[model samples]
Target: MTAQRACGLSDLVQDEARRVEIDGVPMAVVLDSNGEVHAIGDTCTHGDISLSEGFVDGDSLECWAHGSAFSLRTGKPLNLPAYEPVPVYAVTLDGDDVLIDPSVTLDVN
Candidate 1:
């Protein structure tokens, strides 16, 4: 599938996560403090909670229910309770738009 507009750049706040679903695939779109945009799976691997509703610290998104921190860049869980890594999608910036393709994930290894 092609890249679709997830949200506008103005809709995102630094160090915050916004949940966006594309083609039934849920994703967490984050804009870090460094002005970099990242897209990762929204569901917490440790629980059924949404990762977008969690905390964004630096480049990682921490699960509020289990304290499992997932890297926004690699999508790998940095702590216990969640060893499974989430899919990291490539983010595209088109003017004020943030585009992402759910079928296209980055090989962040």
Candidate 2:
């Protein structure tokens, strides 16, 4: 997988997220409380809404529409209304930049 620069490290603050379109895929790049970076599908599995528009609490990413929080590391839904997991992409930190490979996604298996 090729890593593409999504945003500058300074652009993304702690416990915040940014919505980016990489390779025609809508991705929500988030910064967690652990100071690590994560990427998940911007669209919530439960409904047609952008996860980037939601809020980030620690490692839990919540949907703005119906309040569903998903684990940042696993993309596993932590609450009801969403049973299936969303696609999570790989993330990398290089200097003061955050990179993500939209072409790569977590295998449900």
Per-model TM-score versus the true fold:
0.98, 0.92
Cα lDDT tens digits, model 1, 28-82, are: 9999999999999999988888999999999999999999999999999999999
Candidate 2 pairs with clashing backbones: none
Residue pairs with backbone overlap in model 1: none
lDDT of 1 at 48: 89
Query: Per-residue lDDT for 17-96 in model 2, tens only?
Result: 78988889998888888888889998999999899999999887999899999888889999989887889998888999
lDDT of each: 0.96, 0.88
- The regions of model 2 sitting more than 4 angstroms off are none
